[model samples]
Target chain A: MQRLDPLYPTCPIRNVIDRMSDKWSLLILSTLNQNGIMRYKELNSAIPDISQKMLSSTLKRLEADKLINRKMYPEIPPRVEYSLTNTGQKLMPAVGMMVDWALEYFDEITK
Target chain B: MQRLDPLYPTCPIRNVIDRMSDKWSLLILSTLNQNGIMRYKELNSAIPDISQKMLSSTLKRLEADKLINRKMYPEIPPRVEYSLTNTGQKLMPAVGMMVDWALEYFDEITK
Candidate 1:
């Protein structure tokens, strides 16, 4: 029972799984993987049905986790682009597998 | 853009990914896969740091989503056990991949 909390001192794997399983985190990573680097507005436009607030919040969280790099260009219109960091890039394979799984097995599961 | 929201009417895969990526759903399925059938209290005991409320809620969600089968026995103590459904079993490969990915990549990312 005590082993379940990945946050526990002994449970080193917990945090990693938690981050990967995060809802918007994986989606944001997938979007960036497919599109390369994208600006805030671009991402928002790319991911339909995501509220501005959710997008902003999700990006901030991803950036803080160091999974995505946020580059801000100082200009009249704030130019902020998000790309996967090296660490984030390493995760793309796993993320890609998940996306593939979704595409391959969704119909079977639903039907 | 419109293609990103898997939940949209046109997005058939949305619901499947949503269910698999659900926080507790994957974990419960993994636990069941490894241990076969486990009673409610046994599962609660097996997964450390999960609140009873969360465990109960997560189990109910998995059951409702048809990812797990719940069986209740008539006895002195309530005997409710959980196991993966066929749909749930089909998802194990993907879920196993995720767990493997976590174990393989966490050290790289965190370092």
Candidate 2:
């Protein structure tokens, strides 16, 4: 059996939280949740000000995490669409909780 | 008034979430919550496997954020105790929600 680290002690779960809570990751998930599946260009347009490199890297990371699905089409410009996997959908409630918390406490923190 | 970026667009909030969700930050917050206030050495001992450098850096960052209050008493030996500020206490509910979500969905994600 694997030894589980104590909650307050060092553990791998910390890394997981860090990855999931990344600015790009949360925003990407939020966009996908709202818009269903979207093409790469469309996604880029949807999230203004994100550099092309950062957006691509963020998408790649999410896909590697199995949270999002990337479908590619053999078209002239190589059409691609990104959507949430079952695991990604499962994360909705958790992300929603964060967003709600943020909205509720934004004033307190920002002040 | 400053121009607020769209939620879906790139914004500074992402950076904030990233910092708060860092493994060390969460675990430190959890420890502080359970222990009320703790000296630096006590905190280090409480969290096993955390390197001295990482622990020190994490504490500094939290203090800079105004989330954790660091009190240094004037004595023969330097003694410092860390506690939560009102802002930090307010963050409890948000952090709790994340922990609850992790616990509830751990099986699903890990499986």
Candidate 3:
């Protein structure tokens, strides 16, 4: 028997869902999964609809959650890149399933 | 390679995230997963904080997404029950993983 207590906001499942189930986060994950490491500009272009503000905020949240690794290269221009951590990679399978589920039921849901 | 185009608003992945990533849907899924079959009142009690309106709306959305099945018994008092469908059941593994991931990083995220 699993201890499912998502009734509380502090529940682990609730926390994960609150962070991972967003459109931008999923999109960001997909983008990172496909492109390997990406800079802010790369992520911005890859996800066309997200605003700069949204991207920065989401990236900060994802990093804070330890889902992604943000590396800052302090060069002349200070290049920064983002990629999924082991934990984030583990999350991809679930995301894949959700995408598959969505695709399978797209017609039914849309109609 | 995996057709990861969650960029569009109408995209299936986008649709799924928008619908399923909310706190209520996750709670509803957790409740249904544990209880197997539940009535509206059962779901309400299981998730203490959700408003009646939120529960009703989320249930309707989940059914529309073909994730859960809603069966209404038109008896003396008219009972209604909800449970995950095949698709919904398929989603549980991913949800389980998310919960596991969250628990692993709870301290880091909370602090």
Query: Per-residue lDDT tens digits of candidate 2, residues A1-111?
Result: 122334532333453565565557878988899899999999999877788999999998878767789999999989999999887886776667666656654554444
* Candidate 2 lDDT tens digits, B1-111: 122345532333553565565557878987898799999989999887689999999998887667789999999798999999787886776667666656654444433
Provide per-model DockQ scores.
0.29, 0.25, 0.42
- Local accuracy of candidate 3 as per-residue lDDT tens digits, A9-108: 5677666666766667888988899899999998988877898999999999888777799999999899999999887887787778777777887766
**What is the lDDT for A81 in model 1?**
89
In candidate 3 the C-alpha lDDT for residue B104 amounts to 80
TM-score of each: 0.80, 0.72, 0.85
Once fitted onto the true fold, the runs of candidate 1 whose alpha carbons sit more than 4 angstroms away are A1-12, A108-111, B1-7, B74-78, B107-111
Q: lDDT tens digits, residues B35-66, model 3?
A: 89999898998877889998998898888777
lDDT over C-alpha atoms for residue B33 of model 2: 86
True interface contacts retained by model 1: 0.24
Candidate lDDT (C-alpha), each: 0.71, 0.73, 0.79
Q: Residues A1-111, candidate 1, lDDT per residue (tens digit)?
A: 121344454343465566656556777788899999998888988777788888898888777767889999999887998999887887776666666666765555455
Q: Which ten residues in a row have the lowest lDDT in candidate 1 chain B?
A: B1-10
Q: Report the number of the highest-lDDT candidate.
A: 3
Clashing pairs in 2: none
Chain A TM per prediction: 0.86, 0.84, 0.87
Better of 1 and 2 by DockQ: 1
